[model samples]
Target chain A: MVIAAIAIARIHDLFAVVMLTGIFSLLGAAAYVVMDAVDVAFTEAAVGAGASTVLMLGTLALTTSKERPAPAKNVISALIVVVFTGVVLIYGTLDMPIYGDPMAPIHHHVADHYLGKSSAEVGLPNVVTSVLASYRSYDTLGETFVIFTAAAGVLAILGQSRLPRRHHDQEDSEKGMVSSPEKSKGAST
Target chain B: MEQFPGLIPYWVIMVLMMMGLYIVIAHGNLIKKIVGLNVFQVSVFLLYITMAKVEGGTAPILAEGIKLYSNPLPHVLILTAIVVGVATTALGLALVVRIHNAYGTIEDEEIDKLEDQT
Candidate 1:
C-alpha cells in the first residue's frame, strides 16, 4: 500500500497518479475484505479501483501535467498550521482505544444494534446497505444532496467561460447550432 | 523474534502513512500530491485489513468440515469504500486535467497564480 501511494505522490505524470490511485483503492478494498465486509469490499474494488481511475485518466488526457512553483510568502504559516495539526493528532492518540479492542466504546455502542438487529428489522442481509437505504433513508437523501453540492461547488468554481457575441447574419446561417431570439420567435410562430 | 507487543506493525504503517501525508502536504504539484494521498490512504487500508485477521480463522467460506470462518462483512465494506475511492480519484484527476488545460500548469501554486491573474 505504501509503495502504491508513494508511486502516486512522487510521480509528475498524471496518468501514473491515476494508476496509483487505482492501486490504492484496490488495497483499500482488500483491507475492507479483512474487515469482514465482503459486499462493501467488492463494490470498492470494482467502482473505486476500476471505473473512477479510468475516468480520471480520461480527464487527464484533456489537460496538462506540469506544476507551478510555490510562492515563498505563506510557507511559514502553512508549516505552522501543519505542525500544529500533527501535534493535536498525536495528542488525540493518547485517548484512542487500542486497535481492535472489543471493549472500546465504539464497538460496544450502537454498532451492535445495526449488526444484530438491522437484518431482522430491514430484512436485508447486508445491514450496512439496509441501514443506509432504508432505516436511514433521509440520511442517504442528504448524502445525495451533499454529492450534488460538491458537483455544484466544482462547477461554480471553474465553469464560467467567455463566449464571443455573434452577429445576426452569422447566427442565422448556423440555424441549427445557435438559437437566437429571432429564431425562437420564428419557432413559436 | 523480538515480539514487541503492538509495536512493529503500528510503527511500520504509521511511518508509511506519515511519509505519504508529508508528500501530499509539501508537494505543490497536483500529480505529486495525489500520489502522496494515495500512499497515505494505502497505509491505512493495510492497517485495517491486517486488523481483521484472527489467530486461526479459516477462509470465510463454508466447506464440508470447516469449523471457522473469518469475518466476511469487513471485506464487503472495504470493497465499497475502494469503489468510492476510485471514483473520487478519477473525478479529481479529471478535474486536474481540466485545470491544466484552463490554467496551463499542473502545479497547484501555478494554477492559483493563473486564477489570481484572471
Candidate 2:
C-alpha cells in the first residue's frame, strides 16, 4: 500500500496514478481483513477499488492524463511542514491505548452496549448489522439522507448530461482524441 | 508481540496521512488533490479500526461459542463514512469536471494566471 502511494506520487501519468489508487485501496481493504473488520474490508474493496476507479477513469478521459510538472519551490516547503506534522501525530499516538487492548476505553461504553445487547435486542447474527440497522437506525437514516443530498448535489453539478467542454482548445489539446465542441456535443445530440 | 502494541501501525498511518497532506499542498492538480484526500481518509479510518481492535477477537458478528468480538461501533460508523465519502468524492469529481469546463484548465497555477489576466 505504501509502495503504491509512493509510486502514485512519483508517477506523473494520471492513468497510472488512478490504477495505483485502486491498488492502494485494495491493500487497505486487505489490511482491514487482517485487523478483523470484514465488513469494512468488503465495502472498501467494492467502493474504493471498484466505483472510485471507474469514476476517476471517466474523469481522466475528460481531463489531461499527464500532470504538469510542479514548480520546485512549494514542494520543499510543503515537505517540511508535512514532516513536522507527522512527527507530532506519531508522538500523540504514543498515548493511545495499545492495539486490541480490550481494556481500552473505546471498548467500554457504547461499543459494550452494542456488542453485549445487540443480539438479544435486535436478534441478529451480525452485531454490526444490528447496530447499524437497529440500535443506531436513526443515524443510518440520516446518513441515507446525506447520501441522497450528495446525489442531488452531484446531479445539480453535472446534471446536464454533457461531457466536459474542451476549454483548452486555444492552448493545447492534452488528449487530442477528445476533439473540440463538435465531438463532445455528439453525446447530447 | 510487543511491536504490535508499539508505534508501528500509528507510524505507518501517520506517514501515509502526511503523504496525503503533502500531495494536497504541493500538487497543483485538482484530481490528484482529491486522490490525496482519500489517502488521508483511509489512514484515519484505519486509525479508528485500530483503536477498536480487541486482542483475539473475531469480526463483529454474533456466533455460537464466539465470546470475543472486535468493536462494532467503529465498523458501523466507518461503513456509513465510506458511503458518504463515495458520495462526496463523486460530488467533488463532478465539480472538478465543471471547473475544467469553466476554466479550461484544472491546474491551480494556470487557473490563477487566467483569473489574474481577466
Candidate 3:
C-alpha cells in the first residue's frame, strides 16, 4: 500500500494515478481482512476501489490528464508540515494501548455489552448489522441523507443545463465529424 | 524493542497519513488532490479498524462455537464513513469537471492567476 501511494505521488499521468489509487484501496481492504474487519474490508473494496475509481475516471475525461509540476516552495512547506504532524501523532500514540490488547479501553464497555446481548436483543447473527440497523439506526439515517445530498449536489452541478452545447458553426469547423446541432439538440431534449 | 513491536502499526498509520497529507498539500492538480484525500481517509479507516481488532478474534458474526469477536461498533461506524467518503468524492469530482469547463484549466496556480487578472 505504501509503495502504491509513492507511485501515485510520483506519477504525473492522471490515468495511471487513478489506477494506482484503486490498487491502493484494494491493498488497504486486504489489510483490513488481515485485521479481522470483514465488513470494513467489504465496504473498502466496493466503495473505495470500485465507486471512487469510476468517479475519478469521469473527472479525468473532462480535465487534462497531466499534472503541472508543483512549485518547489510548496513542496518544501508541505513536507515541513507533514513531518511535524506525523511526529506529533507518533508521540500521542505512545500512550495508546498495545495493538489487539483485549483489555484496551475501547473493548471494555459498549463493545462487551454488544457482544454479550446483541444476539438476544436484536436476534441476528451479525452483530454489526444489528448495531447499524437497530441500535444506531438514527446515525445510519443521517448517513443516508448525507449521501442523498451529495448525489443531489453532483446532479445539480453536472446536469444537462451545465453541459456544453454543440453549436452549428462549431460542428462545421470540425469537418462535420460531429452530428448536426439539430440532431444533438433533439437527442438532448 | 518489545514496546517498539507493539507500536509498529501506529507508526505505519502515521506514515500513510502523512503521505496522503503531503500529496494533498503539494499537488496542484484538482483530481490528484481528491485522490490524495481518499488515501488520507482510508488511512483513518484503517486506524479505526486496527483499534477494533481483538487478538485471535473472528468476525463479529454470532456463531455456535466462536468465543471471541472483534468489536462491531467501529466496523459499523467506518462503514457509514466509507459510504460518505465516496459520496463526497463523487461531488468533488463533479465540481472539478465544472471548474475545468469554466476556467479552461484545473491547476491551482493557474486558477489563482486567472482570478488575479480578473
Candidate 4:
C-alpha cells in the first residue's frame, strides 16, 4: 500500500494515477480482510476501488490529465504543514491502545454489548449489519439521505442543460446513451 | 523496544496519512487533490479497522462454535463513512467537470490567473 501511494504521488499522468489509486484502495481492502473486517473490505472494494475509479475517469475525460507543477514556495509550505500534522498524530498515538488488545476501551464500552445481544435482538448472523440496519438504523437513514443530497447536488451542477452540448456528449456517454445506430451509420456512410 | 512492536502499525498509518496530506496540499490538479483526499480517508478506515481487530478473532458473523469476534461498531461506522466518502467524491468530481467547462483548465494556478484577469 505504501509503495502504491508513493507511485501515485510521483506519477503525473492522471490515468496512471487513477489506476494506482484503485490499486491502493484494493490493498487497503485486503488489509481490512486480514484484520477480520470482511464487511468493511467488501464496501471498500465496491465503493473505494470500483465506483471512485469510474467517477474519477469520467472527470478526467472532461478535463486535462497533467497536473501543473506547483510553485516552489507552495511545496515548501505544504511539506512543513504535513510534517507538523504527522508529528501531532504520532504524539496522539502514544496513548492509544495496542492493536487487537481485547481490553481496549473501544471494545469494552459498547461493542461488547452489541456483540453479546445483537444476534438475539436483531436475529441476524452479521453483527455489523444488525448494528447498522437495526440498532443504529437512524444513523444509516441519515447517511442514505446524505448520499441522496450529494447526487442531487451533482445533477444540479452537471445536468444536461447546465453543460454545453460538447461536454454534454461526454455526460451522455457516461450514462450509456450514445448516438443512435442510424446516426452512426449515416456518419460512416 | 517493548512498546515498539505494538505501535508499529500506528506509525505506518501515520506515514500513509501524511503522504495523503502532502498530496492534497502540494498538488495543483483538482482531480489529484480528490485522489489524495480518498487516500487520506482510506488510511482513517485502516486506523479504525486496526483498532477493532482481536488477535485471534474471526469476523463478526455469528456461528455455532465461534467465541471471539472483532469489534462490530467500527465496521458499522466505517461502512457508513465509506458510502459517504464515495458520494462526496462523486460530487467533487462533478464540480471539477463544471470548473473545467467554465475555465477551460483545472489547474489551480491557471484558474487563479483567469480569475484575476476577469
Candidate 5:
C-alpha cells in the first residue's frame, strides 16, 4: 500500500496515478480483511477501488492526464513540511495501545454494548448491520443526506446550459469572469 | 521491539498519509490532487480498521460459539464514509470539469496567471 502511494506521488502520468490509487485501495481492503473488518473491507473495495477509479477516469476524459512538472522551487519546502508533520504524528502514536490489543479502550466503549447487548436489543447476528440500521441509524440518515447533497451539487454545477461552446463566446462575459485583477488588468479595463 | 508491539500499522499508515500529502501539496494538477485526497482518506480508514482489530477476533458477525469479534463500530462508520467519499469525489470531479470549462486549463499556475491578467 505504501509503495503504491509512493508511486502515485512520483508518477507524473495522471492515468497511471489513478490506477495505482485503485490498487492501493485494494491493498487497504485486503489489510482490513486481515484485521477482521470484513464489512469495511467490502465497502472499501467496492467504493474506493471501484467507483472512485471510474469517476477519476471519467474526469481524465474531460481533462489532461499528463501532469505538468512543477517549478522546482517549492519541492524542498513541501518535503520539510511533510516530514515535520509525520514526525509529530509518529510521536503521538507512541503511546497508543498495541495493535489488536483486546483490552484497548476503544473496545470498552459503546462498541462493547453493540457487541454484547446488540443481540438482545436489536436481535441481529450482524452487529454492524444492527448498529448501522438501528442504533446509529440517524448518522446513516445524515450520510445519505450528504450523498444526496453531493449528487445535487454535481448536477447543479454541470447541468447548466450555455456551457463554454468556445473560448471567446462572450468577450465581456469572459472578462467579467476573470478572477485576477493583475495580469489581465489592461485587457479587462 | 518489546516496548512496542504491533506499532507497525501506524508506521505504514503514516508513511502513506505523508505521500498523499506530498502529492496534494507539491503537484498542481487538479485531478491529481483529487487522487491524492483519496489516498489520504484511505490511510485514515485503514487507521480506524486497524484499531478495530482484536488480538484474536473474527468479523463482527455473530457466529455459533464465537466470543471474540473485532469491534463493529469502526466498520459501520467507515461503511458510511466510503460511500460518502465516492459521492464527494464525483462531485469534486464535476467541479474540476467545470473549472476546465471555464479556464480551458486545469493547472493552478495557468489558472492563477489567467486570473491575474483579468
Candidate 6:
C-alpha cells in the first residue's frame, strides 16, 4: 500500500498528489493506532496529515503544480531502488515474528512490563505517552531538533529576501497597477 | 465466532487507510489530495478508538451507578488530532489560492518553469 501510494504521488497531478500525501499520513496514523500506540497515531495524524500538508500547499501556492518530465536515465535508478527494496524485505521476513502471535519474543519481553505495570510504575495510564515523554524522552527531544533543522534548511534554500509583486493586480483592474516602491527598486526607477 | 467482531474492525480500518493513501497519490487536483488526507487521518482515529474499546465497556467517566468503563484516553487524543488536521487543511487551501494568484496556472509543471526562469 505504501509503495502504490508513493508511485501515485509521483504520477498524479500536484493537487491530487498533495491530497494523497495527507491520505498516506492518515493511513500511517491508523496503522500506529491499530498497533496500540495511540500517542504516535495522534502525532502522525496532526503533524503529518495536518501541519505538513498545510505547509506543502502554502509552498505549492507560491510555485507551479506540474512536475518536469522524468529524464530517461532516472528510470534506471528507480528500477535499482525497487529491486533492492524488494530483496531486503524478502530477506527480513525470514526473521520476523508471525502475524500477532502472543508467544512471539516481541510480546514476551521487556514490553510486557510497560503493558502490565506502566500505570503503577510511572503513575500514568497511557503507556505509550509514558514511554515517549519519560522513558524515551531524549529520543523525542532529538526528533524535535530534527524537525527544526529541516525547517531551517528549507528557509535557507527557499527564503526570499523580498516578496514577489503581484502582476495579478493589473490583470484585475485593467489600468495596469502602478509598481510599488519595492518594484521600483527592481525595475525603472 | 465471537472473535469475528474483533477482527472485522481491524480489516475495515486497514482498507480505509489504503483507499485514502491511493487518492492522495493518484489524484492531481490540490483539493482532492486534502480530502484524501482527511479520509486517511479519520481511519487512524477509528482504529485507535476500536482498540480502546473493551468487550462490554462504557464511558470512562465515573458515576454512582456506572461501571465497566472503556478507555477514554484514545478518544481524547483523537479529538485533539482532528482539530490539528482541520487547521492544516485550511492553511493548505489558503496557500493554493495564493499560488494561483502568483502563477497563472495551478498545474505543478508550469510552476517549475516559472521557478526556473527566476
CA lDDT, candidate 5, residue A170: 51
Which docking band does candidate 2 fall into? medium
Greater-lDDT candidate between 3 and 5: 3
Per-residue error at A151 for model 2, in Å?
A: 1.3
In model 2 chain A, the worst 10-residue window by lDDT is: A180-189
Give the DockQ (2 decimals) of all models.
Answer: 0.23, 0.54, 0.58, 0.59, 0.55, 0.09
Of 3 and 4, the candidate ranking higher by lDDT: 4
Cα lDDT tens digits, model 6, A146-189, are 44444443333233323454445534222112211212121110
Residue ranges of candidate 6 with Cα displaced over 4 Å:
A2-12, A152-189, B1-118
Q: What is the TM-score of chain B alone in each candidate?
A: 0.85, 0.93, 0.96, 0.97, 0.96, 0.84
- The alpha-carbon deviation from the true structure for residue B19 of candidate 1, after best TM-score superposition, in angstroms, is 3.5
lDDT of 1 by residue, A1-189 (tens): 767655654565666667777777787677656655465566657665665555555445444444443345444554565566556654545454444544545443555566556656877655556656676667556545544444443343334222232222333223312222222222111
Model 2 bad stretches (over 4 Å) = A160-189, B1-5
At residue B18, give the lDDT of candidate 5: 88
What TM-score does chain A of model 5 get? 0.85
CAPRI-style docking class of model 1 based on DockQ: incorrect
Candidate 6 residue-wise lDDT, B37-70, digit = tens: 7666766777656655544434343344653434
RMSD of each: 8.8, 5.2, 5.6, 5.9, 7.6, 10.4
Per residue, candidate 1 scores C-alpha lDDT tens digits across B1-118 of: 2334433455556656676766667778776666566666656665555454443544344344654334344443443334334434443554564455455567766656666875
Give one digit per residue, the lDDT tens place, for model 2 in A110-144.
98888887778889988888888888899889887
TM-score of chain A considered alone, across all candidate predictions: 0.68, 0.83, 0.85, 0.85, 0.85, 0.71
The alpha-carbon deviation from the true structure for residue A94 of candidate 5, after best TM-score superposition, in angstroms, is 0.9
Off by over 4 Å in 5: A161-189
The candidate 3 chain A region of ten consecutive residues with least summed lDDT is: A180-189
lDDT of each: 0.53, 0.79, 0.83, 0.84, 0.81, 0.52
How many angstroms is residue A56 displaced in model 5 relative to the true structure, after the best TM-score fit? 0.6
